[model samples]
Target: MTVVVGTVCVAVSCLIQSDPVAGLFGASTFGLVSAYTALFHTPRLLALCWTAAAATLTVLTVRWAGHDLAFVVSSALLVALVVVFVTFAGRMTIWLLDADIFHPNLDALTGLLNHDGFHEKAATLLTSSSRTDDRFFVVAVVNLDSYSLLRSLAGTIGVDRARIEVARRLRDTARSNAVLAHPSDSEFVIADLFTEPDTSPLIERVQGTINAASARLTASIGVVCTPLAPVAKLPAPDVIDELMAVASNAMYNARRAGGNRVTYVNDPALTVLDAPPTDEWPDDDTR
Candidate 1:
């Protein structure tokens, strides 16, 4: 679309204007089209548009500027340079703005996505998976058990180290495509789409990983899994929030019953299932 529009505009400007130089000036309107592409489209498309504009301008200049080879070459070169500058400048500005905006969405200590970042990425993932029949969305909320006690004993620096360590462990345990976030000092959230509905092995792996981390850290994990078929029509943000809420509730239940346990909830009714105790980590005191 950009190439077609730019070509037509360049051709019309060159043919209609009486002065060839003025016609070249009029064709500079292609910069507007280039600007649009730079803002909303990829760099590749922007480059393609620029290339087409340059070619059209060169061809028209040669045909219209009779006997003046210098004018023909100089005018085309000048207009193409101006368009190139505008397109690249606009792209750089957009890149800087995006970097500035996304900085706040990351946790400073753990370098993980914060709550807002998690919501944005999770919503996008869910929306993309809505049409897939075999995919399910899984949301897990993890709270480090006895975190306050650890903080008091270890002091600020120690607590920060522990948080970083826990974040690393969680990152290692989670799948590559999972959206992992450190929303609070003691809480982390993981959301992802899975082809298989059964997440028992994943949950257990997370529990085991946290248990193995330094500072004797154990986490209460709450998970909610829902098939894409039932909630495909719902808004992605709302669905993510609902699932997180249910998972948080289950996490609280696990913490209340005894920490270091996994609680699973199956949505949309939000049925809670307390997983049986595993002999792998028999010590309840770690919870």
Candidate 2:
């Protein structure tokens, strides 16, 4: 869209201006706008390609409008100036945006991706993967069942240490393809997708890891996976939410049943869709 609009503007300029330099002025303006837009939204190599294409078009328009060689060279120089200026401006703006927006994606406690970072990576993976390849997600909610009791008995420091240990166990258990995030103090949410591989072994491994962490702590696990049986496709955001809800429901069930178990539900509709199990967490822990 940016390229098309800029090309059209350059064409109009060629038609209205008799002088080569004047004809180039319009292309220069278009280049400046395009450079800014591309810098904000496009990769460096791609932006360079766009600038080169625009410069070529500017030269053509000047020649087509019957300008002298000196005038054409001068117009070409203008395009170069636009490229240099835009490149520097775009680089600076992108750096600022990255620093401000992306730096906070990691969790401070666990050194894992936080909620925003998890969402960002999940969206990217969901968009890139195709349903044709049996691509799907296994959204897992792993919570320390004994967190409240541990906090009561050992105080804040002990609970923090236990949380960090649990997070480390989970990260170790998850495969390289998985994305792990610490969304809450006691709960560590993990997303397994992209590879469309079996999650059973990994789930079992994670459960075992947490169970062996400490006798005082046990993890309640839940998962939601896709391409189960009937549903081959689902909207990205809807699927994410539904899976989270179902996994959450299973985790709640696990917590209700004494807390040291792994549970998963592929079909969310079969599960109770009422208000999330109120019995799941204490009031202070509401996200």
Which of the numbered candidates is closest to the native, going by highest TM-score?
1
lDDT for 191 in candidate 2 is 81
Model 1 TM: 0.59
> Candidate 2: global Cα-lDDT?
0.69
Give the Cα lDDT of each candidate.
Answer: 0.81, 0.69
lDDT of 1 by residue, 69-135 (tens): 8877877778877887887788788777766775878887898999999999888887776464677
Q: Which lDDT tens digits does candidate 2 get at residues 143-220? A: 888677889998988888888888888878887767888888888888866345457787888888887886357789
Each candidate's TM vs. the true structure? Answer: 0.59, 0.54
Q: Which 10 consecutive residues of model 2 have the lowest summed lDDT?
A: 228-237
In angstroms, how far off is 58's CA in candidate 2? 69
Q: What are the runs in model 2 whose C-alpha is more than 4 Å off?
A: 1-102, 194-198, 214-216, 228-234, 267-287
The reply for model 1, stretches above 4 Å from the true place, is 1-102, 270-287
CA lDDT for candidate 1? 0.81
Clashes of each: 0, 0
